[model samples]
Target: MLIVHVAVTVLLGIGAFFLLVGSIGLLRFPDFYTRLHATGKCDTLGGGLIILGAMIYHLFQYPETLLVSAKLAFLIFFVFIANPTATHAIMKAAYKTGVKPWRLGEERR
Candidate 1:
């Protein structure tokens, strides 16, 4: 349906936008922790949105591919669960390694 197409397009576009913003933040942020936060949160949301859009489009376009749809659903669920957990793990490791948090007006040690 035309409405479904439009909605899918919009969702994909927004997802792409969030991914772009997250990438920019990763590069531009001054500190490791800030960059991690930006990329972790934004990438999770962005990836989820993209996966959601694809799942919707596939559901409408290929009603017979129930298995494929289920796989996509699994991917969505996995990314949602895994991305943040990985990010948190990385942050924890960084903390354990003595990577200091950035403070305002203080030089990075």
Candidate 2:
């Protein structure tokens, strides 16, 4: 359906936009923790949106592919859970290893 196609297109575009912003943040942020925060948040959202778009498109375009949609849903769930957890773990490790947080008036790391 035309509506479905339009929705899919919009979702894909927005997802791509978030991904681009995340990558830019990764490159531009001064500190490692800030960069990780940007990427961890944005990547989870962007990837979920993209996968959701794909799932919706597949559902409407090919009703037979229900299993695929289910898998995509699982993938989205995994990303949502894994990304933040991994980010926290890495941040904790950095702190334990004496990686200091960026302070105001300090030179970029």
Would you list the C-alpha lDDT of every candidate in the order shown?
0.92, 0.93
Query: With candidate 1 superimposed using the best TM-score fit, by how many Å does residue 36's alpha carbon deviate from the native?
Result: 0.8
TM-score of 1: 0.94
13-52: candidate 2 lDDT, tens digit per residue:
9999999999999999989989998899999899899999
Candidate 1 C-alpha lDDT tens digits along 1-109: 9999999999999999999999999988879999998899899989999989999999999999888889988998998899999999999999999988999987744
For candidate 2, give the lDDT of residue 107. Answer: 89
- The true-versus-predicted C-alpha distance at residue 68 of model 1, in Å, is 1.0
Measured on C-alpha atoms, candidate 2 has an lDDT of 0.93
